[model samples]
Structures are given as C-alpha cells and as structure tokens.
Target: MHDPKKLEEGFGDLANEQQLVKEQDHTRNFDGDEKEDSRIGTNQPMEQNQDEQSRQQQTTAVTSKPKNKRIATLDAFRGLTVVLMILVDDAGLAYPRIDHSPWNGCTLADFVMPFFLFIVGVAIALALKRIPKVDAAVRKIILRTLKLFFWGLVLQGGYSHAPSNLSYGVDMKFIRWCGILQRIALVYMIVALIETFTTKLRPTTISPGFFSIFPAYKWQWLGGFISFLIYMVTIFTLYVPDWSFVEHHSDGSKRYTVKCGMRGHFGPACNAVGYVDRQVWGVNHLYSQPVWSRLKACTYSSPATGPLREDAPTWCRAPFEPEGLLSSISAILSGTIGIHYGHILIHFKGHTERLKHWVSMGLGLIILAIILHLTDAIPINKQLYSFSYVCFTAGAAGIVFSGFYILIDIWGLRKPFLFLEWIGMNAMLVFVMAAQGIFAAFINGWYYEDPDNNLVNWILQHVFIDVWKSERVGTLLYVIFAEIVFWAVVSGILHKLRIYWKL
Candidate 1:
C-alpha cells in the first residue's frame, strides 16, 4: 500500500522512485524529435572559434534539459526568462537609465540574466541523470562551452570600445573578452564535468524504468556560501584602477554622480559603471547618450578633497560599470543558490506545500540580503553581481518555480504558455537571433533611434500629457505591454510551427 496523496511516497524504493521521476521526465520525449530538429551537436565536435577555425567538427549541443518529462512549469519558467530578456534587451534604447547599470546599481531589467542563469542550473541538475555515455557528454561539454564563449565574444565584440588607436572609435581586441552566456557556458561545463567524474564513481545505472543517485545537497548550499564570501572578499580587496577621467566644471571642487547606494551621489552605481558600459557597449562608443558620462569614476570623493583639489580633479566620483566581469561573481552565485533550492526541493520530498515553500524561502532571503546589504558585509550590487544580488535573485527564482509547479503540476492547471514556451523550446535560436549582426543591425536601424523619440515616450508625452494623465509608472507599463506583445507573437509563431533553433 502506498500513499497516493503523498507524491514521493508513491515510489516503492530507490529504483521505484527513479521510475516515478522518469515518468515525469519530459526531456526524454524531446530527445529524438526536437533535439534533431534543432540540429544541436549531441555527440559531435565543432570548431573552437567561429572566426578562426576552418576545420569543421561534429558534436552534440548542450541544449536545455527539460527538468522532467511533461514539466510544463519548468518550460514556462524558461520562457518567462526569455521573454524578460527580449523585453529588456529589445526595448527602445532608453539610453543610460533604461539600460543595465555598470557596477552596483540595478534597474527593472537587471534580474533577467540571473533568472536565465538560475534556470540553466536547475535544468542541469535534472539532465545529469540522463546522459547516455561519458565520452559523448565530454564532447558535448567542450563544444557547448566554446560555442557560448564565442557568442559571448561576439556580444563583446559588437559592444567593446577599447581600441589600440583610440582615435575616433573603439578597438575590439582587448574588450574584456567575455559576456553573460560565456560565463554560463563555463559554469555549465564545470558543473557537468564535476557530476560526470563524481557520479561515475558510484556507477548507478539509470534504466528507462528509473534511477537513484543520492548526492549531498549540502554541497550546493556550501557552494553558494563560498561564492558569496569569496566575491565579497574580492570586491573589498581590489580597487578598480582608473587611467581616464574628464575634469570637473569651473568649480575646482568635485562634482557628485549617482550611485546604487541609499545616498545615490556617494557611490558610482548610478553613474560610473553604467555610464562607461553604456558608452562602450553601444553601437556608438562614448557618444551613446544616457550613460554617456564619459570618464566618470565609480567612487565618491572625500569632503576635504573638494573633489578637485590640486591633488585630484574636481569632478571625481565612482564609476558605474555593470556587466563588468567582476560583478558576474554575484551572477554565478545566483546559479549556485538556485542549485541549493533544487537540492532542497528534492530533499523536502514531502511535507511543505510547494508554493509556500518557495515563497517563504524567497521572502526570507530578501530580508537576509537586505540585512547583509546594510552591514556592508555583502553589498547588493547588480553591477558587481554581488552576493546580496544572489540572495535576492535566487530567492525570487525559487518562489517563481514553486508557484508555477504548484499551479501547473500539482493543481493540474497546465495550459501551454506556448508564447513563452516557444522561445523556451528554442532558446539558443532566440538568443542567437538577438545577437546576430544580420537582424539587430538591420532591424533596429529602422525601428529604434533617437531614444528620446521612442513610442513609449511619444505615447506618454502626446496622449497622456494631453489627457492630463501623467504617471511615470504608466510609461513603464506601456513599455512592458509592448514587450509582452512582441514575445507573445514571435514565440507563439515559433511554437506553432514547431520551429526550434540551436547554435
């Protein structure tokens, strides 16, 4: 007799538990059809560099693993992240304010990467159980890592402004060399390799019926803690060196720039990193408006220094440099924290209600992150991808996962979020499309421009202003609506046509 009411108890034993989980493993069903359609390198090798490599190799693509069979919730979450990515990414360039902050400050759009990375970790945990052979897995891992790294370079290439000549524009060679997907690729390979070698020691066979591999999830938790601590240590220890900065106005005293802290002027969160990144990462180098405070630093000056004493320039302040690789440490911990949540999800097995479990933990994490932030123990900086960011973001992701799981899985209310699911299904394609020169260069050339002249601005100024219905939130809402419509249509079309994409 088994307790049908209790989910985990349905399994008779470890093998039975594996069988139960297998039944729910949606990834298996996707293997033959969608996998091939995407033309992902499942067990083949590919060239290391897109630009340099002339030789072609075959290998498997490490596409996303459906967390479980028929796990619509996971798919939905992935789609949700993609949708957010597009909106934040594709929105009419609002200049410095709308774009990502460089170092410490976060905006409405900053959570997007953390969400995507967390999903990557979540899917990896589930997929590790299903790899057919170790050799094939290794091949897939290398190819995928290279592909991601290459893509990251492409993003950096398009955006980097550090040129050898530095005359009228930027030089592509020394542009920091990495981006978001590149980091994800590195972490994914590392985690997969770790799983491969360690799990091999046990040699537990995962028959189609079921399989069981007991991993101490404590590792997951510890990894998050370690990453957070190490990141804080690094941040506090290392001071960013500055070689370029324009001087202040007539006042031989310093000028203040906004930062991510409570007193916005003291830190460079709002200005320095954000301005520099926006300047460097755009199609135009320093002239790209908004974060165009070229030569701004990321630190607040001392009152005594007057910002522009004979010793230093008057306009000194901290710089904003979000998307700085250093901040990625916070982003990495987001994945690590997410891994712990996955571990806990498996560990709890029963007792806690799913959504409540996720929600409560999320709230707790938010509080903790805020507290840590106040202590300056772990600053919450999106630019630095600080641990505070990890705590808040991971908590948010966990709650989201819980809510969707309960609604779609437990409550039996699974409807296709086909709109999001479509992009989710072919995430690689969607992102590649986003970065490719052919699309963005051509399309955005026509649509976006004069960030001051965006439709959101137009609507709010013309219609809302005339009607005396002025609300800044409405501007944000209008933008959000536009984003939703864009993703819904695009993703829906892809989903309906069964057109999946890969790299």
Candidate 2:
C-alpha cells in the first residue's frame, strides 16, 4: 500500500479515463447540436473564409425554412372563404357572379359553402390527431354539433315579426329546420363520428417512401368513399312524385305539378332534390329569396342541356335552398376528402412532399369531375350536390389551400397576409356576428344625418355610386369596403386580446 511508484501509476490511469469521458461528452453534444440545426434548416460549411457563392447558398437555405411554426396557409384560406362569403352575402344587385347559379351550374358564390365545409373537415382531422380518447372526441363532436345547430336556428330561424310589438315569440309553423348553419352542424357531426370511429379502430404506422403516400388511417378513405357511393346510388335510384310545369290560362297563373317518376325531370318542378326538400320541410320553411328569384323574369338555357326555349320551365320561384337536405349527404364526402388532405398536412415533414401530393390530387379530382360532367354520368349541380360538383369544388378548394400553404407557410411571406389570418382565426365569431345582423345593424347605425339627407346614402350615392358611374360596381365596392373596415377592426381587436372563439 505504501509503494510510491505503483500509486503514481494508478493515479495516471484514473486521469486518462477522466479525459476520455470528457472527449466523448463533447463529441455527443456537438452531434446533437448538428442534428437540431439540420432539423430546422440545412447545415452549411463553417469555413474560416467562405466564398460569396457559398454564403448566398446558406442564406437561401435559412430563408427557405420559415421561422414560425404556425400554418399561415390554413388561416389565410379560411379568411379568404370568409371574406368571399361576406362579399357575396352582402351583394346588392351588384354582380350575378356573386350570386348562386340558378339551379344546376355553379357560380363564384357557390364555392364558398363547399369550401367552408372542406376546411371544416381538414380542421377536424388536425384536431383529432392528438386526441387519443374516443369518448372525449365524441363528446367534443356532439357538443359542437348541438351548439352550431342551436345558434343556426337562433340566428336564421323564422321568429315572430311582432317581437317589437310584444305579441309573441317564434312562429313554429314557419320555422326553418334545414338552414346553412344547421346543415354545416349536421355534416360536421357525421364526419367527426366517422373519423373518430375509424381512428380508434384502424390505427396505422407511417410507411417510409414518397410514393407510398396514403392516409395514415385507411378507414377514413373507406368511410368517405362509402358516403360518396351512397349519394350516387340514391340520386340514380330514388323514386319520388314527378314534377312538371303546369300552365293555367283560366286563372292566368302557372305552377309546378307532381306527376310520376323523375327521369328527365331536371327542371325546378321535376327534380328529386327540390321535391324531397318540399316534402320534408315544406316550401314555406325553405329559403324564400334564392338567386333564382331574380332570374325568374328571364329565360335561359338549362346548364345540363345546350339551349332551352322561353317556355322551357326554367323558372322556379319556389324557395329551394342549394344547401337542401339530400345534397348535404354528398357534402359529407367533400368534408371527408378534406380530412384526407389534413392527414397529409400532418403526416408529411417535407414541404415539397406536401405540395406535390396536393397538386396531383387536386388536378386529378378536377379532371375526373370534368370527365364525369361531360359524360353526363353526373352533372355538376350544386342544388343536388352532384358527384361532379363535389369533386370539382373540392378539387378547387385543395388547390387554393395549397397555394396559400406555399405562400404563407413555406415562403415565410406572412406580414402582408396578417389581416386575413386575423379574420380567419375568429371565423365563427365573424360568421355569427354577420348572421345575427349585428354587423349590419352596427354599420347601418354609423350614419350621421347630413344637411342634404342621410349621410350614408349621400356617400353611397355621390361618392362610390357617382364616381364609379356603375351602380353594380359602386354598390359592391361600398359594401365590400364597409365589411372589410368593420370586420377587420373587430377581428383585429380580438386578435390583440388573443381571443379565439373555438367551437
């Protein structure tokens, strides 16, 4: 124990081990740092003196990966939908394009609802990915569905007109059961349930490969496809009392009549969708002022057919909502497709991979829809929520979503689009406010009476209407300006307060 030479040797060995451990730790830390850097952005050469070319390359790589983790694209896409919705809804004899197509074809206004529904699907998918408990997910779905339905009824339901007179409350006879919010709520419930059950039963592991791309949960596809098939089967096979145009000369009046089965019954009277809606909710409970009402005085060609005669029964004055009962079944498919897209967004790590998938699928859907429509297998009718219509609109929605994703999420060009994000973040709030006439009432009350008369009318009449020299364009711009300023301020305040109105 007292051997000096042997003790010195032992101490030397211990010192050597300590040094080795330090070196290993240093190496591990360096490797970890490198990995983290690469995860955020590509690693660049750290030379003592780097050339300009290499420096430029590094800059490019750094900028390529956006600094923010938020998906600006979704917000922007939703915001765009909301903006267009307000614009179209507020349109005052301004543009036909802002209005829905008479019956069969689509207008710019028609895309708003389907696009919103698709976005809802995508949102649900993203949300459910982290929620492991099926009961919790179902509870969320049920509560949201009920809330949306109740609010829809309260906002748009036909209540007593004499509320100011203190006569009574809601008129049960005129209550609208199927409305925009009601339909959205129903669709959301069905889709959420499908996703919940599928996610619980068919949990899947991600396959490694670019071309191996598919839904993480295959049951989602199965559910969506089955819904789509159901819609097609029902449309082709369902039997109802036939509708036909009846011209009465004695009373100098005309009305649609029910006759037999709907074979070539594509008009307002003979279509199965309108027939079912009338039977279910009754005509008085449906939308009374559809875009078709304005087009009643004019004769036009049937969108499905080439040309129609003046007396071709193209006039349908009945209150038929495009978002009717039967068409909503196919709407589920649209939302399901959106869910698939949301899965893609969550699963794929690389930006290129996500963009590639979106573009390919979107273009493919559009082409297929066009083919089906041209072949007359399924006409693109928004009123019926035809298969081709669903495909076409959903495809357009995908492409739009991808474009926003690229601009806001990938390129980091976010500042300029913050307004849209603001509005989008509070979508339900804005929608409810607008639907409840809060915004309209506020804007209408903002007027200060002037010497010449009403200031609001004066500005609208003299400034926009007179300057633009086109009532259609001027009135549209005025409403648009008002909406943007008013909603933007409200949304901005909410954003500053960090208030997000969640379902």
Our tally of clashes for model 1 stands at 49
Expressed as tens digits, the lDDT of each residue in 413-482 for candidate 1 is 7655656555566566555554222233333333354534444446556764445564544544544554
Model 2 gets an lDDT of 0.66
Which candidate leads the pack in TM-score?
Answer: 2
Model 2 TM-score?
A: 0.75
Reference-based TM-score, model 1: 0.61
Angstrom error at residue 150, model 2: 1.2
- TM-scores of all candidate predictions against the true structure: 0.61, 0.75
**Predicted model with the maximum lDDT:** 2
Q: What is the C-alpha RMSD of each candidate to the true structure, in Å?
A: 13.7, 15.7
